[model samples]
Target: MPDFADLRERMIRRQIELRGIADPRILEAFRAVPREAFVSASYAEAAYEDRPLPIEAGQTISQPYIVALMIEAAEIGRGDRVLEVGAGSGYAAAVMSRMADTVIGIERQHNLVQVARERLDRLDFSNVIIIEGDGTRGCPEEAPFDAILAAASGSHVPKPLVDQLAPGGRLVMPIGNPNWVQHLVKVTKAEDGRLQQSDLGEVRFVPLIGEEGWRDG
Candidate 1:
């Protein structure tokens, strides 16, 4: 097995840094979190290989570059509260927790919720919490988040997510049909309650299945 420390640094240098993820804090957080711990033991050696890998459910851990890209786009701060939809194995949530004050990761899969919760707990990520629920609805009880990131792709930004954003907050997610080429988009809510959007780039993601997301999937 490759030394994860060395592989992690290399990943940061090549996959993240070279790709233009410039936030120093997010970069350090990516390097610090043990991504291998978030995946199964079978793929532990390939954890830092710069590609998405399958997890317990029919879900996947997003590639390192995409995770870095979304986090950078969100413009996270040490005091920000972040919401992560489709928490999966909790790798992205763990990374966000390092930069944000609190990160709530929502997933509909009960097994994934348990797995992710355990991983976050074992890693001593006190500020990251994993919840099992319909991610499309967002966590209204913890509404008005400083930043929101969706790990899966929907046809459009879920209304519940936009409604939950704090003033001047950013929400990042992939938008497209489940079987087509999707694009990553950044939606920013103005202080006066308006929403602005920008396209990051094309991306491929699993369908965000839930109320307010893809109905058939």
Candidate 2:
């Protein structure tokens, strides 16, 4: 059997921590969740690598560094409710579940939804829920979320997501052409209702598909 624990430690030290992801909570969450369980059996041996790995529904789980970066950027707290767009394999949601009070994952693919739900359930992450729907629409019924993270790249930040953010909430997502490099942007809703935006860094992700995102080709 592969020494997944050792690989995970090395990944955290080289890929995440050295890259400046210093949040103790985020680091601990990564350590708690087994990335190997999130990927397919075929890819289990490579789970702790720095690169993103393929999952069902043609989706790719975000790299560990990227996931940690987004979570740290959002500044999720124990009392906050987090909504994850493009839940993918539910790995990111599981990580956030450790830090946030509740995590609602919106995934567009039906197969992925089932897989994510099963994984979360089996792992006993009772605070996480995976639902199937158009992620771009945001989870209106569950809003307003304290922190929102979108794993896919959209042309712009969906207005609905911004509207669903609670006062003082933060949203982290990638914005730009999907085929090209995208800017990881963070939007914060100020107490007075104004939106403040900042760029985290460059990243590449699949196109976010839905009414408010890129249209299906």
Candidate 3:
């Protein structure tokens, strides 16, 4: 078996510390989560390598730095309800569950949803809810989330996600043209429903697929 604890320390140093991610809450979540369990058995050894690795459903898990960055950008707090799009492998959602009171994750692939559900269940993370649907639309039934994170990249921010953001809520995602580079964006919605956008940095993510997003061909 691989030394997961040792790998976790290395990941914190190389991916979280060296990358300028200064949020202590985000760091703690990264440290608490076992990333190896979220990846495939074949790639378990490389789970902490600061690189994106293939997961089930033809999707790749985001790099640890990117995950931490996005979570930090969201500025999650204890007792906050969060919505996560593209719940690949359920790893990111699991991390968020630790920081937030509740987490709802949506994935377009049914198989990925199943895998994510099983993974979270096995880990005894009861605070996460995984659904199979078009994440671009967001989860209206559970609207007014305290924070929202999108794991995939889209040409623009989805309107539904913005609508679901609670007052003083934050939404973080990669936005840009698909098949090209994207910018990691952080959006904050005020009580009046106006959104303020900030650019975090450049990032690459799988294209988001949905009616308002890139259509998968």
Candidate 4:
């Protein structure tokens, strides 16, 4: 077994410090979550490294810096309800569970959803609920989320997700084609339901597969 304490220190330094991710809340969440627990046994050693790791169902856990950046961009607050697309191995959902009042994560792959649920349950993260569905549509039953995050990259922002956001809610996602580069965008819904968009930076992510997302034919 690896020394989780030492790995946590390294993650703080390399992933957060060197990347200029300065949010204290993000740092605290990263430290509080045991990333190794969400990764495959083969990739546990690389959990602290600032790199994306492959998980089941051809999905990936985003790099720590990207995770922190997205979470910070959403500006999650205590008592907030968050919606996460692409649950993957449930690492990001687990992190959000620590900071938010409730987290609803949707994944397209059934296998990944099962794995994620098992992992979160093992860690006793009851605030997170994993659903197997098309993430591009968002979770209509759990509408009016305070914040929405997409773990995969899409050619455009799905309108369904925007509709589900509560007033003043923020949605963070990576937009671009799989064969090209993508930009990380933040969308905030105003009280009157108008949406404002801001481009944060460039990012590359796996394609989001769903009704509103790309078809994996």
Best by TM-score: 2
Q: Candidate 4: lDDT over CA atoms?
A: 0.91
Model 1: per-residue Cα lDDT over 80-178, one tens digit each = 999999999999999999899999999999999999999888889999989999999999999889999999999889999999999999999999987
TM-score on alpha carbons, each prediction? 0.98, 0.99, 0.97, 0.97
lDDT of 3 by residue, 1-217 (tens): 8899998988898879888987788878888789999999999999999799999988899999889988888989999999999998999999998899999999999888999899899989999999999999999998889999999999899999998999999999999887788999999999888889999988999999998799888
Cα-based lDDT for every prediction: 0.93, 0.95, 0.92, 0.91
Question: What TM-score does structure 3 among the candidates reach?
Answer: 0.97
Candidate 1 at residue 76, lDDT? 93
TM-score of 4: 0.97
Runs in model 4 lying further than 4 Å from the true structure: none
Model 1 vs. true fold: TM? 0.98
Q: Which is superior by TM-score, 1 or 3?
A: 1
Report the number of the highest-lDDT candidate: 2
Off by over 4 Å in 2: none
As for candidate 1, its clashing pairs are none
lDDT of 2 by residue, 56-165 (tens): 98889889999999999999999999999999999999999999999999999999999999999999999998989999999999999999999999999999999999
Clashes of 4: 0
lDDT of 1 at 164: 98
Clashes of each: 0, 0, 0, 0
Rank order (by TM-score, best first)? 2, 1, 3, 4
Q: How far is candidate 1 from the true structure (C-alpha RMSD, Å)?
A: 0.9
Looking at model 4, the pairs that clash are none
lDDT ranking of the models:
2, 1, 3, 4
